[model samples]
Target: MTDRRRFADAVFRGARSRRSLRTPHAPLVPRRPPAPPAAPSAPEPETGLETGEPVVFDAFTADLGAGLPTGMALLVVIPVEQGGTPGFRLRAVCCCASLVEFGDVYGRPDLALGSLVAADGLLPVDVLSSMRTWSRTKKGLIRWLDARRAAHGDDLQLVIWDQTGYGIPWELFWLERAPGSGRSEGWLGGLVTVTRWLSIETAWGEVVRDYRSEHTCAGPVAAYVAAEMEHDVSLFGAYHLENSDSLHTLAKALEEGDPLAMVYVACHGTYGARLSDCVLGGVPLDRFDPRRFDRLGPAATFVFLNACHSGSLVDDAGRFRDRALRGFAEVFLRSGAAGVLATSGRVGDRQAHEMADQLFRHLRDHPGRSVAQAVRDLRAEMARMTPDDLLDVDGPEGNRRLLPLLYRFMYVFYGSPRTAVSLATGKGV
Candidate 1:
């Protein structure tokens, strides 16, 4: 236990320092510009999912507790093996109390995660069961949290710092009600505003540095929800850069524009047991060569990366791979975007689209809200939505009712926590 504490202490110290330091944007190295992309392929036919019933991405679990006391929180960093099954040694460090614990993950972490967040191949009941099973295995961690809550009171917040190659959905962990409280078990999202962060060295430093200029530029908001919403420029007001052609062209277009506000993307994403394998659309972010954007000059201040594993990173086996490549979220920050809202893994298309739309609505309707507050409000709003409001049908669909709650917890905000969206009219703060 002493040795574990010492190790966790070291990691916590490093995380603290990195959180404090900011990495200045590296000077753009002179290089040839990227080639133009081929014309966009014809739009595919709309699937029933897209034009189907409105999917309300709810984060509520029975009684979603009022968020932890403002600013008071816990940060847990878990070490994971490469290419290993989702199961891992639970060597975690808690920043709030400087607490550290070593243990094993519950059940087949991979299977539970797949059933809960897998993009395909699982029934709604299977998904719910998988989620419950995953949470059940974490009884040890829950006990630890219960102790902390008892000691520190209910105001303490919970923020998970994911450092593993296989991204675990921390939000799914179920916390039972206090003895005789007469309430059922509740997922972590219900009790607090649960958020996640990357633990790689370079990513943290870049976030610290880029965060300073997160809202420096005042530009129009841009978006590309889907092939159908491509021409809906009014969706975001002024600029709506459709995911036309390819991601390469989108990057090029944003590059040409002066310092812009934010770019929103909604598309299929893929992740592997390895964090480096994460991709947005069809482009792998880790393998993305900085040289590709070398000549680009547009600076997008913030991004809403509504893709799987876009905010994930693993500590390379050793110091050798410490900062080898940037995490998917950091890729945008390094490319001049100061902040990002990303998911740790694959999310259903319905939930993905709902998150994108609601996020924009909150940012637009409430300019006084910072990005963090906007997100919190968004989470709370969705959590507040009753089951009736979210359900289209009563019986069979109700079995999968938890889908909305699952997605609500998948989004993890990266970069400066205080940074908010700045619209072209300069209203959003």
Candidate 2:
């Protein structure tokens, strides 16, 4: 059998054996209070057996844990077919532990999940606040995370490796409050530093990167700002490329062997029917193919695509099924960028600019914080801020606002959560 087949078989057999041999442990701490029951509807038929217990497989663990640094974990989700039914296998591994669980089979497409993505690949923010359906897969993953957090501290950094390409928006998963814990429940992304990765193959070696080395220092930045936002270009203190000619300028920078610390793009982005149609800075995304450029420049550690829908990975059907049509975030990641921060949906123009400003300011002011940690802190801060505080609005507008909370979850980071961007001097990017 091929390597892929062999690996899958081993995982399946190992999961079964492990489940049979070991008794599941109860949570060490009190479980979170259950969410209010949803409106009753016809029950969907089960497609496969549910195994909520964590399974340990040595081969899988070793492969995933080979180069994982301490305090960091990889959550691998792969779509699979068992007995002609489509399902997913969820696995997580850190330096010291491993856990695997089988997710519920997909008998039919999830309309709620599909509703998050619009026809143009942009997310409809209105659907976010009312979302109640939590997939069994998500719940199972949460249980695993709860156990991990209980054993370890909440400082763990998570790298989600999603082979399903469904664009599940893992960061926005609602976390319930632990009873008497005194911690308010919030989005998972705000609670922890989370990043994402996508690999076609099942092998861990194919997707592993040495993140420690990339966390050392901040290098030169290359900023591409729209004409209207030229005022923000000085924030990076790097070569400023106007939006109209950003493509050419970026190409020249790559060809000239310029070592860049960061590539910040502040422009308008629009989703199209296909990946090629997606536009950034008035240029088609197809023009920025990483393969066309000989190099992405040395130390190209971080990319901040501060634009609407720049981070989305969906295709024509508003789903992430078309792997070949990946978004700008994936493009930069494949181009050897250590980390990328982009938006998953439409963002208010003012909020988008403010978000970028806050991010850079936080990075510069706090020299020791990692990009992911800074993002997490910022999300939490935004979540706590009322509209009156954030937008300086009056009581009526402030009480009826949703953008502050919604905008915080729109920004998604894809890379090593622990990868630090040093700005010890606290001066420029």
Candidate 3:
């Protein structure tokens, strides 16, 4: 194995659990997405940041895998599109000793997140079984996972590496039915914890990651939004920045000596060549190097990229170019962030606000909640939301129902599944 693979193996080996594994039931399919409507015009500009007390996090006491599903850890590798053709696949190196599964699911070359929702909403039982079978044969790792889970318990960390910008909502696999009734059950975040990883080779080297970082707190929690997103930024109680310099300064401080719990960024995001062509204030992530903010103190750091396509990794041009990185989220990870919450495709202001509200509220209400668990809660909350919950905007009121569905599986978590922030302690779990 190469040095990067060796590093990944070590990280997962350190996190390997000793619990019994049970095979998962048939996988579930995602809820079908609604037909998309015309895109909305950009919102007006407004700027200012609302700074606040630093959040306290109890890293020493926080359990890395507390409350997480206990089962064989799973790593999946999916294919990305390049120049309208499928490119070499990205693989998920395993941390679980019992099993490491790899699969190749094809995605479009353009990497545009066409629909956030599933096509059928509910996949049939036969299809679910077929999926597992296909994964076993085509991907060549599911059978071992099944056997391990059957022997142990039905819980696994489903780590996904979507370098190609495929829009598959892996969370919606339909697993089973209610014992007596026809009522069907699906595999939402409640049952499975989905974490994303970056697989691009950079100038420094291959960006192999350590997904198990202990939580730590540096100081007070702070937030920043692009000038245009001041309205949404205020929802998170964060001050908005007018340009990239201020954002860079804060990032620099976090890397050097500043105490920062979390940074919320709301701005415009675009995808081409790669994901995260996002502009915060007047600064584009392309011009901003996240590595400049390395060694972010003892406190674990989080970055919420509340921008459309901020996490999209569509184009494959220059993917192997020496300093070329995938998206803003990857940059943050490369720079030293413990975790990042970003959207896979275009997301609206309303949806982004709803996500932020859920994330912060969960952190505020539940001290020491693992970032993975909080995100699990967030995914569950989003799954439960309906169009009725959204405010009617420019689109057809009937079509508005799709908004919540569109947001489903659009947001991805990059970093340690065990990493979490506590507003109460101002530290990472």
Question: Best candidate, lDDT-wise?
Answer: 2
Candidate 3, superposed: residue stretches over 4 Å from native: 1-72, 78-97, 100-155, 163-168, 172-184, 187-190, 200-209, 231-255, 274-280, 295-297, 314-325, 385-398, 424-429
How well does each candidate superpose onto the true structure, as a TM-score? 0.61, 0.71, 0.61
Scored by lDDT, model 1 comes in at: 0.47
Kindly report which residue pairs in candidate 1 clash with one another.
Answer: 22-208, 22-209, 23-209, 64-190, 65-190, 69-155, 255-298, 371-420
Q: Tens digit of lDDT per residue, candidate 2, span 92-204?
A: 76666754544444432232222243222222233344332453335666666665555556677877765544546677677665567555566778777788765311122
Query: lDDT by residue for model 3 over 1-429, one digit each (tens)?
Result: 655344334322322211111111111111111111111111111111112233232342123222224442434333333344444233333333432223243333322232211221211222233333333333343344344334443234555543333444455433443246433234444445667655533444222235544565434555556555566645533322222325665555545545456666666555444323344434565676444554433455667777665564433334433322346776676655677887765555556777777777787688776666677666666545643233332223323343455465567787667666644331232
lDDT of 1 by residue, 301-334 (tens): 6678765555654333332333233466655655
| Better candidate by TM-score, 2 or 3 | 2
Q: What RMSD, rounded to one decimal, does every model reach? A: 17.2, 15.2, 17.9
The CA root-mean-square deviation of candidate 1, after full C-alpha superposition on the true structure, stands at: 17.2
CA deviation > 4 Å runs, candidate 2: 1-62, 81-87, 106-126, 130-132, 135-137, 180-184, 200-214, 237-244, 290-297, 314-325, 386-400, 423-429
Give the range of the ten consecutive residues with the poorest summed lDDT in model 2. Answer: 27-36
Ranking by lDDT: 2, 1, 3
